[model samples]
Structure formats: C-alpha cells, structure tokens
Target: MSRSFIIDGSIIYTNYSQIIGQSKFEELLREFVDILKEKQSPLLNALNAFKVNSDYDVHRFTEYLHLLTMRNIKEIGNIIYYVNPKDLERFIEAFYTFWRSKHRFMVRNEKYAEDYNRRASIEYTVTMIGDQFKATIKNLYRELMMNVSNTFPTVMRQLPSGAQVMFLIQEPNGEKYRKNEWVTKIPTVWGAIFDPPAIFYTKSNKRRGILPVVEKDILSEIALDPNEWYRFAIYVGDLLMYNFVHVEYLAHGAGLANLFELATPKDLESREPDGILIFGLPADKIPGYNEKWRNGVIFKEEDGYTGVIPAFDENDYFGYMKKTTLTIHNLIKIDRGKLPIHGSMARITLKSGKSVVAMFVGDSGAGKSETLDALNRLEEVAQIDTIIDDMGSLDIIDGHVVAFGTETGAFVRLDDLPPGFAYSTMDRSIFMNPDQINARVIVPFNNYNEVITPTHIDFFLYANNYTEVHNDEERIVFFKNPNEALKVFSEGKRMSKGTTSETGLTNSYFANPFGAIQRKEEHHRIAEHFIKKMFETGVKIGEIRTMLGVQGYEKEGTMLAARALLKVIEQI
Candidate 1:
C-alpha cells in the first residue's frame, strides 16, 4: 500500500501524478491534437473515444486534463499503453525500480521460482512482438529485456478496431519520442490471470452431450458474478447471438469476435438473438448441468435458444473458445434447417473472368486450409479470394444449396502453410504458443461483407488429405452419385497430422464435430437435404486428393490437387 500503486496480478494502477508529470500529459495532448488536424487512422481514432465540444473553436484541453485524473485507463503491452510512455526515463526508472524489488518477492514463491528456472520461451518476443512494438514506438525493447514476461500478453492479443482500449503516441510523449500515447483502464483487475488447475485440452477426452429439451432454467438457482459477465454479440453467418463470457477466458473468447462479425449495436438492439452462449463459467455457476458433464461441454436446447458451456478448461487451449462458439452457431444452423460445415471455401477467378466457388469439406488436419492455400498459389488461377477459412454453413436458398461463411479470419496451423505464408500476413496476425507444436496464427483475411453474402457452390469437394494421386486427372475424382458422396462425406476419415489431440487415422461424423456431431440426427436430416439439393442443382461433387497428410507428399500433393482443380473448373 505504501507503493502508491494498486497491484492486482500482473496489472498495476496508480494516480497519474505518481509516475508522469502534468507537463508530460499536456505535451502528449498537443501531439494528438496535431495528428487529428493533419491525418486520420483507426488508431488515431482512440482519442475520439473522448467527447469533443463540437461547437468550440480551440476548446481548452479539458478532455485531456480530465483523462489525466480519471481512472479506468488500459494498456496493451507497449503496442498500446495508457500513461507514462515506455521510453520515458520516468517510466523506465519507475518500472525497473518497482518490478526489480517485486522480483525478489515473486521469486520467493516456490512455483514461480521453478517456472522461472525453465526457459521463458523468448522466441515469442523475437518473432512477434520484439520487433513489432519497440521498432515502431521508440526502439528500446531489446534493451528492456526484464519486462518480457508481463509484456507478452498485451502485445499478442489483437483488439477489434473500436474496443475501449486507446492508442498511445497519437496522443503522448517521452521527450524526443513525445508522440507516444498509452491506454489506461481504471477498473480493478479481478481474476484476470489466475491460473487454476485446468485440464490439458485434447480432442480425445472432450465429449459432447446434447439435451433436446431442458425444462428449466439451469442458471436460475446460482448466484452469478456480474463483473465476470461480458457480452460479445457476433454473427456466425447471420446467426447472431450474444456470447456472455467469463473474464478469465475472455481474451480467447474475444478471438471469436476477430473471426466472425461482431454484431453491430443497431442489430443487437433491434433483432432478437438467435442463440445465447455462456462460456468459461464454472459448473457450480450452473448447478443443474454439472451432473451430466463431468469433463466435456454440454449443448442443449433451452427455451428455444441453444447453449454450450465448456465445464472445465482442461486443455487451456484456444480451441475451447473457438469450438464452443462454433457449436452454438452450428446448433442454431441445425435447428434452422441448415448444414454447418467444417471446411474451407473460396472464390477463384481465371484471367477470362470465369469464376468458380469451390468448397473442400473435411475435419481438422484434413487439409481444408492447406489445400486451399496451395490452390491460391497456382499460376493459372488469376485470383483466389477466400470465402470461408474454417467453419461454414450450407443452406437451401431458392432450392439450391448456398453456402454462408462463419468466419472472416482463419485459425491456421503454422506447419500446414506454404513457405513464407504466415509471415506474409504477419502484421495482421496474432500468434498463439508459437514455440510449441500445433502453433497457430489467427489472421483476418477477408471482410465480413464478403463472407456473409450467400454464394452458390460450384464444386462441393471432400478434401482427401490422406491419398496421393500421381496422375493429374486422378488428383480429383468425381463421386459417382449423391449416395457415394454422402457415404464418403458422412464417414469423415482423415490421417491426423498432430494438429489436434488425435494421432494417426481418425473419423468424425461429416468431418465436423462442432454441432454436426452433437446433433447428428438433426444434422443428418439436414445434410441429406443439402447434398440432394447440390446434386439436383448440378453443383459438381467430388474429392480433391490434397495428400497433405500423406508422407512425402505435403506441399507437392496440395499443388498437384490444386492443378487438377484448375483443369476441372475449366472443363466444367
């Protein structure tokens, strides 16, 4: 308490005057004032979060003055910090003086000491944030090696354009680098980074149980924590829902907002939500359901809305946040007579203006993304615009099976990508556990308008990542009929590439475990209808042998399959 700063977990908040002087805040305001007068950017707009006296000519710096005192400031590592620019001699001195002493206290903890003994996985800072922030702001990052542990979380999490967080520099300064601004959040950091005993997430043990009809409100009896409740209204292909997430898992939950369209306030206010998903809640918070799911998630139809709750964070993986959100989306699709697909889709165009909308359906590690990436690289393929990267839905519109995309971004495996692929989009990507196997990069590739628009399927092909086709023509084999297509698709088989918990050969119903597997009966009825509609509508159905999971094939197999696809599209 004598330190004049409130320390909660990894976050610290104190009076502005404690670290930064009044002159620094004013100097900061002047720079942003200049930027607003000359240029505009999504980042520069963080200042716009503060209201302006619209009628005033050169109104006093009253807003900035109030900000200097007002609490609830926020920080995103050095990428975005609230006050006291990282390079300011004051900040460097203040932080070093404080954490240096605290390090002694923290090292006293046996577990902290043990973990510190292990390598800190410094590679994250090297590739992702080391060059990212320090190079941009003031270029003093590497010199500040001691701060890596606390800085990593803030730099890696990408915020949506208008999140309450603000951009520094467009607003503040550290003498010569006086153009820097820092975001500061005033609220208490409650349960923000508490590492509870969580299950290691593996695809194998995570079971799914669906309750067709739940008669009562499961949450009615428990006392819910209000501060922990945060809402993310996202559109998974227009199936809009309010996802209420627990603050502990909120960062990962917010990842869903990055991929899917975060529903606008206008829509959220006007339209009724199609579903309500509550993620990261303790089983005790929802008493009635724990008896059913000892470890896995529970998908149930409650009062006309679908719900999915992952009872535990066993694996501490991003997949929990992603898959649970998809499950809610898919279940809603199942109820609305649509088929939720776990696959990749794109719109490829040739030089002659000929366009083909191709869909490669498969489970995780079946080359849904890798094959499509390879397809984009083909010389003859003039342009390939991705429509859906991971999850999508098939609906019968005007008696044809039309597909709608569920995500604008992709949660792509680093190893599956072609050389220099992930780095190509480094600026827009967020890397998760980069030093470990099954590392991934979450990058927003397409816009919401592109993915949400209903597009007809030109080719509905199953991704055969396991098989190698030597002959060009043999790379893509057409299904004899709808039954054959249904048989191959429903019996979703693929060689696991260690991207998931499963190893070697595996089978998932329809290559989709999200909601399709949870509500198989309903999904089957819907799948049959859509596949039949595809055949009736003359949508080319077949299997593209990517050979991505096949030994010695890898990138070559995908390129070969892509070549075959180009020829097939031209022939069609």
Candidate 2:
C-alpha cells in the first residue's frame, strides 16, 4: 500500500516556495531552505518522505505533531507511503488502523507523560534557568557575610579624610571562583577611583559569607554613640599608635586591603557618603567616647589586646591592631677628654614638693665626682636621688612627674652588688697625672649649669677645682650677661695674693676666707634662690629615665616624669 502523508508547516520542495520557507520554525526554516536550494530534502533522501497539501493533510500533520509533543514513539512513523484512492472511506479506515498500531508502544511508554510536561514549550525552560541565576547571587551574598564576621562591631571616631584603613576577614571562600568574583571587583574599583575612606571594619558572620561594617558605623559607634566608647577607644588607639610608630597606615590581610572604604562627614551629608557605615547616634555621645579612645592610647600591647579585647568580646580584630608608638632617641658620645672636665648641670626638682641642691659643674680633675661622692653620702642628698647619670626620658601621666634613674643610687655599696654586676657599675673612680696638665694655657669653654640650691656650691666647686683652685673667682654675679661675667674673671689678678706656704705657693684666692668664703657665700645664695626660679618651669622624672637608658622601662617612666613636671610647674 502506498500510504498518504501530510506536511502542515511546509512542503518538502525540490525548489523554493513562498510561505513554506519563511513561516517554518527556525530549525525547520533552515532545513526547508537547504532542501529547496539543493532540489532534494535530507528527510526525503533519508526516509523517502513526500508532502501532501489539503485540509485532510493539515489535520493529519496536526495530529502527528501533537503525538510527537507527548513523546509517543510508537505513534511516529518509520515509513510513510503515498496513496491515491477514489474510495475515500476504505482508505481512511485503513489509515486510522495503521496510525493506531504505530502509536501502540508510545501509549504504553512511561516517559510519555514526563516528556509532555518538560518539552511542552520554550517558556518553561527559560523560567527554570532564571531561577538558577537568582540562587547563585543569593549564595554569593551569604559567603561575603561569612568572611567578615571577625571584625564586626568595629567603631572609629574623629577620623581624618583620606586615611587608608582595612577590614577584618575571618573565613574566606575556597571556591573555584576567584576571590574577586565574589567581592564584585567592578564596584570596588569604582569606589577606589572616586572615593576612598580611612578604613573598614568587617567581620564574618557564621551564617553569612562576609559582612561589611563601613564608615557610618565607625562614626556612630565611636564618635556619635556614648556607649560605644570602649570600642571606639580600641580602634582609635590602633590608628594613633600605628600612625605614630609607622608614620604610615598598616595593611591587614589581602582581602581587607580592598574592602576598606571610609567616607567623610561631608560625603555622608550630601548623600555622597561620608563613610561606609552610618549609625544614627546623637551628638552628646561623641565627646566622651572620643576621650576614652584617646586615653586607651596609653595602654600597652598586652593591655590593649588582652584586657580590652576580651572586655569588648572582640579579641580577633583588636588583637591584630598594633597599640604602641615607637620613638627612638640617640645619645651623644660623652667626651672623656675635656675637663675642667665638662660637667653637665640640669635642674632636678624632686617629688617631695621641695627644690634642693642638685647642680654641679667642675674644672677637670677638680673633684666633680668627689662632690657628687660627698652628696651621695649625705642623708639629705640620698632622699632626692639622681634619676639618671647621663640620660633619661620624660612623659606626662595624670598631672604628675616621675623619673627613671638608669644608674643605681651613687651611694650603692659596691660590696653589696654581685661580683659580675659590680665590675660594670660606675661606683669607683681613678684620678692620676695631675702634674702632666697644661697649666700655662687655659682652654676656655662655656656651659649652662643646673644649680638647685646654694648648697650646690660645694659640689660645683669640688667638681671644678679639685687638684688646683685657679685664681678664677667662682662666684655668682647679678649681671645678666654670662659672657661679661666671664670677662671679669679673665681680667683679674688675686686680692690678698698668696705667699709661699709649706704645701706650695698659695694664691690667696684659693684659700683666703675673704676671697674663697666670700665667693662661696655668694654662690650659695644664688644656688638657693635660683632653684625657686626654675620651679616656674616644669621638670620631669621620665626625662631622667630616657636619659640614663633605664632597663625594661621607658613608656611608663616617661608618662610619670611628664606628669610630675607639670605638677611642679603648677606648684611653682
């Protein structure tokens, strides 16, 4: 039997035709165009296909397409034969029987229902794909939150513009995608190019991927909110100490490097963005919080990291921020060769709220050490002890002044020290070669000396003129100009000039009560009175420590000395 077939969409043409080629579906359109140009159809060549055009053909095509849409394999034909018959009833019955037998297996195939639901139309496939994209973006946001959980609740106050800062990241993604993909590089690049903020505060929330805590939160938490001072103090101290020590901003981990974007108040107000995070805090809460952070600067690494971090329950972020400012001071080499060996004199004000004899200057080999030696033995001198032999630091603390003396008290008994330590201690001195001195030519020099009291006269003289008291009258002068005062010393010969004595030829200025005692008396009065003048100036103990290179202590000592000096100034 040569069975008839219908092609509803387009005729399988050996030559191109109008509506059939144009109106066909895309795949079918291409097939029709190719077949028409070649004058042969791929379908016809492969399966011996033919086309029929009529209402009956159209009806048949529609019926077949519907079965195919349902994935009814048996209903589809492996071979369709062309037919011409005048007895239409007999032909129709035979055709229907053939169709029913061909589709029998398709009806029993379990996938028929499944194929109908899935391949019903193109719209269903597109809707499924859209849902998948949404889910991916949602997950990416979650991952960002998880990474930033560690530095959450970060706060800052009084931040300057254009300060580079960082956020903290705890859990980073280990996915196949690059970190940039997750962070959204395009937006980050735009932020950097247009506006950069001081720093970022971020933390990984366990449930989320990463969370960004930006400039607004920093300001409100620290600058605007009163309760958040402790948090503010922590970050501020980190900022200040980092700035002070490094003189530059510190970069945290790599991801944090890009994430920090701080904005200024002006940026925020204009809707331009002042900072990244903005908390709505009141104005009154600002000052106190700011002050707390300022004070937190005094805390050490341990205090800042351990005590403060735990206090706020923010150990992760706080632990990483550096807390102390580092300052290095270099000491000048002491000239051992120079004498009336150069004696240094600085005003020392004691904590006892009293000013006493402290200054000493001396001529080379003149017993400067001996005078100090004498004072060291005195109970009074022992009370207002020396803080440093040569150097120290001074810092302010709570309006009080304190000192760190590098050297042990001059009275330290060498015998009491361990043998190893005693060897290094500067407790003993050697004096020799007195006559080898160049006596005829004097190397004149000038220096400012610290004389706290008239009692300092003995020490200064002892330090200056030990072996020989030159005829130079060592007396205090009321004349303001020091050069002119020294000029008077240059011009003079002694009154009550010395005659030969049993010991040696005596210059009366060296021993005569009139010259020696008179000058001593004058210097004593000046020493006692001059200290009162110095009291008007602040002197500190920490200054003593830094000067002397005291062991294992500088920061604390500096603060104490500074405070002490201020107090003294106030009292004076």
Candidate 3:
C-alpha cells in the first residue's frame, strides 16, 4: 500500500497513476508529496516527542523541519520516473525560493508582533494602574513594571549644598518574587547575595565585604522584583545622587525620605540627576546565594555613570544603611570630581563679630560634630550655624576654596550627641536601632538653603580627638606650608572609638573613601591647588587635638576645642 500526501491542497500518492495530461511540474509535486508522506509520520512523532518547550527548542525544531522538507524534495526528484531533469530542477528552485521567503516572513512578522504587543500591553497596564492609584496608596513597583516609558515617575530636590538631584526607579515584575518564593535572590547588580555576615562584639571587627557587580547580569537583576523598593534623589556634596533601593520595610524608605528631603514629582520636572546608585535589599535570607555577593560592596564606573551596590540585610542596622549611603556618596564623588570629607561644617560668628565658615574633618567618634556642637554652646561664640554633620564636599571655585553640605539632616550617633539633642529633633527624625550602640537618628538640622549655598571656607581643621594634648593652649597646630597641610589631610589617621567595627587607629584618604579614594589623583591635585590658594588668601589651615576619642576626655576635649576655635574665629 502506497502512502498519500497533500501538496498545496492537491492529493498525491506514489501508486496513483493519474499522470496523463498532467504538467511535468504537477508530476514532480506528486512525487515530492509521496516521498514526504513516507517520512512524515516518523518526523512528526520525533518532533512531538521532543516538544518545543523553550525558545531554543522551538528554534531548533523549525530548522530541523526546513532541512527535512528540502531533503525530501531532493530525494523524490532523484527517484521520480520519467520526469525531465530540467523541469524538475526549475520546479525545485521555485519551491525552495517560496519556502525560504515564506519562512522568513512568518518568523519576522511573528517576532515583531510579539514584541509590539508586549510593549503595548505593559504601557496600557501602567496607565491603568497609575490611574487607579493616582490619589490613593499604590505600589510603585506595579506602576513602573507596567509603564510604557523607559523613564519612571521621578522626584528631584536641591541639596543643602546647591546640588540638584533626580531619582529614576526601575520597577520589577510583580510575579518574579512570587514565583521564586518571597526569598528571591538579591539582584547581582546590587552587590553579591550572601548569608548574614559574622557578628563580632570585639573591637577591630571586620565588616562584611561588598562584591563588585557582574556587569552582564545587571539587566536581569533589575527586572526581578524581590520586594517593594523606593528610589531617592539626595544631594551628596557636589553631585546629585540617585538611589534605587529596596528595604525590608516601607518605614525605612519613609524615614530616609523625611531625612533626605525627598523631592516630589513636581520637583523632578525641573532638575536632572548627576549620578545613579542601584541597590537591592532582600527581606529574608537568600537561599542558594551566589558566592560573589559575600565579597562586599561593588563600585562601577562607566561612560558618564557611576554607581555602587552594597550588601544588604533587613536587620543590618549599621552596614546596610551606612554603607549604602556611603556608596551613593562615593559614586557622586567620582561623577563630579569633588572631595568628599568625613567631617562636620558650620558657619560660626565670634563674640568680636567676626563670622567665618569652618569645616572640621574627622572620622566617626573623632568628635567632628561634638566639637561643632560644643562651639554652639560657647558664650564667646555669638552664633554657630550647622552646615553638614556627616559628609560634605570641598571644591576650588574661582580660585577660592569652598565647602558644600550633602544632607539636610544629620545621621548622628546618638551615643556621642548631647543628652537632649536626639529628643529635641524627635518630631522630624528617624531613629534606627536606638537600643544598639551605634544608634542613629536622621534629623533635619539645617534648612535646604543652608546646605546648598557655596560658603567660602575661612578655616579647614582636622578634628584630631585621639591626640593627647598636655598643653591645652598649644593644642592647635597651624600648617605653614600647603604640602604640610596636604600631608595631614592625606594621612586621614584617626583612633577608633567604637562608632563602627574598626578598632585601634585607622586611616582613609583625606578621612574619606567616598570621593577622595575613588579619584585619588584628582582629589590630590585639587587639594594641593586649593590649599595653596587658601594659604594665599590667608585662610587658616591647622589640626586641633581635642582628645575626644579618649574615654574620660569627651567634655574636656569639647571645651578646649571650642575655646581654641573661638580664638581662631576672632582672629579671622
């Protein structure tokens, strides 16, 4: 029994002999169909058995089908009886051309339509969701994932230091986390996903490392929504930093929003962001975590963009918030080529009616803020206006050294602050882990205007609280040469007082890793040039040994530093 087959809606078979008066091309087609039928059943069964599951499988199957069809035609041409070779050849060529063209068209059209529909559906969904939650509470992730525009709903604000920032958020797909369980892996772009770090109650405790991101995995990580997240535009020194982040809870975002003076949608309309920081935090422990995530925070710089992703954990009261903010600041520092110093700054007025803007550079527990707070309490000091307490920028503008504040609020260590300080700002502050040793509060200590304005730096001093001063009158050592000033600034040496995991003496480039370390050569050049310029302008450069890093000398050091600072202000 001969098999039957259909070709272009015509029935053909090996045994059927209706060849009389039929065109040679028709005869050829009948032969081809008969041969195809002989092999079709096995091919169909094989294809069915190897079901098209993934895109790769579908592609392989399509290629196999095309090859099989062409082979069958050729086989039939050789076996057909009484068929003219020239006629057969022409028919084969025409059929091949048609098949190829049809296949190409179908593949191209299908892919194009699929992409277009997917995009359109996302846009339509975004519009619907945005409209639904316009006035009420809404999940930003939902709105963004469905959004048609590449740009998300953004917010911008001017930092205290006159830098404007914009935040761009990428929303993750809703089903991504649901499908993977709530414990989805932290996106690789935002540092390595790892188990919790070893907690040490001892001094000199090494914090967890931050892993560099695998650049190739960034997009995939961004698309996965492990949890709800928020993006922030906070002014860090001279750059406007954008932070795309997910915290374990909404309260963290709310707290930071209040602390950073987050801009509204209306504010974003007028400003452009300077740099970006993409970060992700998982609520629960990540299962089967990548080993790279345990390495630590990763800093990436590409074309006009700079960013970092720190390792994240929900209960990490220190590194999670602290390191993430530092990463963002460092990114901005790299982007803007500004000097980010770990310090406190203020505009002080002396009893003699002399006003000077002074910056006290130091590490944590080095009494930078405490010294300034003490200066504010001095009777000889007329008024002391706080500019920035944690991090700030130093820039050379028009041949004059100037300082700018980063945050409007201060993330001060509660243990070091005056007894009533945290309580005084409780209404507008967010206290994190108050029961812990390194308890922190974000309070709006200064207005936005006070932070952004470029203030001429009249004095630059290192808050050397670790150094013991036997002679209190000779506590302040003035540098005669700019090189000497640069040496001290570059050393950034300070004693650890348990504000962080570091114990004993430690040093960072200019007491800052955020800006100075990222751009060492640039910062050094700027420092040299600015120091000389400041010296020529008669701006005082010196180090004041407050000894505040010592246990029993906190009050004594503050008093001595305040009195010396008052004298310096009077002279200026």
Give RMSD to native, each candidate.
17.3, 35.9, 23.4
For model 2, the stretches where C-alpha displacement exceeds 4 angstroms are: 1-354, 362-366, 379-382, 390-463, 466-480, 484-572
Error of 3 at 337 (Å): 3.8
Write candidate 2's Cα lDDT for 1-572 as tens digits: 11111122112222112212333222332333343337542222212123443112333433332333333223344433322222222322333233222101000001111244543432233233323322332332222222222122244232121112211111212222231231111111001111122122322100101111111222212321111110111111001111110101111111111221222112222231100111112324332343233212121121121111111212122112211111101000011110111222333334455554333322122222223333333333223344222222222234332222111112122221223432332222111111221111101011112111111211111121212221212211122333332332222212210111112222222121111222334433433333322332332111111111122321222233223333433355
Best by lDDT: 1
Answer with 1 or 2, whichever has the higher TM-score: 1
Candidate 1 lDDT, tens digit per residue, 1-572?
A: 11111111121223333223334334434544554446543333333433365321223333432332332223232333333333232333333333222111000001111133231332222223322321222222222322322333335322111111110001111112111111011111110111111111222222233323344544334333553445566777777765665555544553554466765333433566666666666766565665555333544545435354554645345666577667777877787888899998999998767898999999877887887777678777788899999888887778878888988888888877765876686655555555567777667789988898899989999988887678987888888778999999999989988766677888888998777877889889888888888888899899888898899987688878888888887886
The sequence of per-residue lDDT tens digits that candidate 3 reaches over residues 1-572 is 11111111122222112221225324433444444447553322322423445212334433333333334433433443223334333433333332222101000000111255664554444333323322111222222222212233466321111001111222222212232232223211111111111011211122443324333323223332533445555555545555555533333343355445554333333555555554444412332245555423443434324343333442334334445566556545544666666788888887777888888888677788888888888888888889877777777778777777777777677777688887777655656566667766656677777787888887789878778877756778899899899999899888877765568888877876554665678778767877788899878899988788776886778778788867765655
Candidate 1 C-alpha error for residue 121, in Å: 38
Model 3 residue 131 lDDT score: 30
